[model samples]
Target: MSRLDITHERASYQAVFALDVITAAGALIFLGLASKPTFQRIKQRRFTAPNSKNNSARDGPLKTTLGTYLFLWPALLCLFIAYVCRLVSDLLKTAGTINYDDDLGWNGRRAYSTADSGYASNISALTFTTALATIFFTVLLNGGVWIHSSHVQENGTGISTPRTKSRIWNSAIMLAMLGTGLAAWGLGIHARDVSTGSSGPHALLSWSTVLQHHRATRIMYIVHEAIVVAASLSVSIEVLREYATTNRNARDSPERKDLLRFAFAVVPLIWLRDIFILYDVVLLYVDTAGWSATAVDATTLLLVVCRQLANLAILGMVLWGAWRMSRSVALFGRSYYA
Candidate 1:
């Protein structure tokens, strides 16, 4: 390759790498904030007492508190920033106007040629998909808050109720389903491009031209996502049941146990989703020669995998808390109510 070609390649590589780094850092920051004690306190405030007539015990500790908003706002801010940055990057790529190759070509060749097809259209679709997924996650987070608040109101001050446990289970299931669906849709779009020879945005539309090329693969991707969602939801339900039983007896219970067992049990299932995600990452990298080599497949699968892992860890923590609840409920039994 000529000097101009070398320079162009290096610039492209750098841009892709920068995007990856930013995405990873944003994800880690979000996860760290989510796991803080303030978040835990907010979640704990949802538990309700069984018999208190005043219902004051069931009222969330942070419902109107500034501290609660402080604890939650940072994560949302980080997510918003990350999403906006990603959208900007995608827009830049689709415009095909940024001259990635700065060095003058030996023969005045364009640094990167624009695709014959309208690049912006394909990118718009991808952006829309991502935005939709983000909305789903936001809804899930809000649902969690609602579920926690309801738990506090129903149980009174000292009594732990089973209904709260059910809500947690349902929330986890919904989140898992949403994540799984997004992953599957992404993979389906990826596979459709690979089957056709067209490059860039045009290749994405290739799916419309050849509907049967990779139909089986697309179906499999959808099924895998569904299974992941189902398994995660099942695990969440089990953990909630254990939590309700444990919390109800904590004061009178003598046996102190860790709920980590339930957490560990669900790890394998949650990890399965990550494993599939990794497979997609490897396949995309190998087939497309990394994001810079292909505009249509520029997304970083690793980032998505990391987010899934963080989610699994969060679920595990909930399980651990449930275990402690189980021990308390077992020891105290009827005395917890008294």
Candidate 2:
């Protein structure tokens, strides 16, 4: 190749490589930040007692809020980093005059490269997935906050009322899940067209052709994402209801038991959906070995099958946990009410 060609290739390669490195670094930072407070809280056994009546008096306002916020710092950092990376990538593309057909210059040419295309698509999927995941995760975290706040308020004010705060939070979570699910469905339709025999680029190129192609794999991914979202929403709702009513008195008190049992039951379903997502990513991104083709696929079909079994195991564990919790709740109710 000529010197010009070599220079172009080198520059394009470097930009793509940098993008990947920065993205990975951001993810690691997020993971580290998220885990720090969790580790500390675990060591402290913060959940040992129900929210104390004098929590504010004992811990003070700043200490309580700071501790709670610290756990969420990592997630916030991840969101910030993701937004920055996306903005930077867009800027570079625009400045480099990157074109779908290499119109502008180095930036355009680099953006159109095969590696760049796959990278961009994968990042898009990951970003959307992470956004959806974060919504549900944050809601759960916030639900915990509401639980603590309700407990503290009741203690301080000498007012005890059935806590419907978590219910409101869970309802919001379900709505968010529904919105994300719809988005995922739309993306899935677009992906289906791309995987099939569509002549045009994916939706990033032209939104109109998004649903042109249809593929089973793409459909499967959309379904999987939807299932995970729904399952997560269900788990959150059940947990919230249980937390709200744990202090209530009932003849059988099956409500709390049922809620706990439902949560345990859904965990495996969520796990299964996660496995399918991993499989879909591997199949969609990685090259596979064939009679004449090179590059071995990193993920195996056997591994995917094993993931299904693993999901089943998770489900079994959840069911067992639910049973145990139910039995314990029943015994407690009988002893207390009898």
Best by TM-score: 2
Superposition-based RMSD of candidate 2 using all C-alpha atoms, in angstroms:
17.9
Question: lDDT of each prediction vs. the true structure?
Answer: 0.40, 0.38
Expressed as tens digits, the lDDT of each residue in 1-338 for candidate 2 is 11112124334444444544454455455445435444555566543233333222223221122233333444444444544554344333332322332111111111131222323343344444443444443343333333333333333233452247645755565556555545644665345334322223652322212222234433443554555445454554544544455434321333344334444554444545555555554444333323121112113233423433333333333323322321222322341210
lDDT of candidate 1 over 154-191, digit per residue (tens) = 23233433356655765565655566556545654566
lDDT accuracy of residue 54 in candidate 1: 32
RMSD of 1: 16.5
TM-scores vs. true structure, each candidate: 0.32, 0.33
Residue 312, candidate 2: alpha-carbon lDDT: 31
